[model samples]
Target: MKNSAMIEACLACFAACEMCATECIKMISADHLRCIALCRDCAEICALCIKLEQRDSEFSHDVMQLCVESCTACAAECEKFAAHHDHCRECAEVCRKCASECQAA
Candidate 1:
């Protein structure tokens, strides 16, 4: 895949979400549980965005819209825990960047 900024942001968001989910899963709490679920969903959506963007799929634009929505929700979820977990803060930052890129794309 070409290293466009959008692609890079999406890939970074995927990695961040995966890491955030892993970290959240390690904690035993209701908030962590919610974050874990959001992170997982965000990771999957980011991965889909990457695949669709790479192939130059006709439906890529539609997928990007979904990606933006997913990223926004994930970012909000992450922000809720960002005060305590560094990983969540990092994930939120990446997700926000990815959402912006998806919108621009």
Candidate 2:
């Protein structure tokens, strides 16, 4: 059974991603915008997957795969922008961890 901790962590990550994405979108430079969008999408998918896993839904397998891939992509994108932003670095670390966990699912 998925515990509350996993969900909480994922939710926190989602929030961080959203915040980072929003900040990136407002920047004058367009460099990190795509990366930020990817991160936001990845975080959202992870959140959905976590919720499904907690419910033990039959669709959890498919959702987990999607979430894992999204996180992997997000982590890669974050790595590209990490040097430019601390939030990107932080998001990358979290996304990597989340990717690993999703892969295990």
The lDDT per prediction is: 0.91, 0.77
lDDT per residue as tens, model 1, 14-98: 9999999998888878868878988899999989988988998888889899999989999999999888889999999999999
lDDT of 2 by residue, 1-105 (tens): 575545655666687678778777777577886787797797778778777878898998898788778877888888887888888888888877776766665
Task: Give per-candidate clash totals.
Answer: 0, 0
The list of candidate 2 runs beyond 4 A from truth reads 1-9
Question: Model 1 — which ten-residue stretch has the worst lDDT?
Answer: 26-35
Backbone steric clashes in candidate 1, count? 0
lDDT of predicted model 2: 0.77
| Each prediction's RMSD to truth | 1.2, 1.9
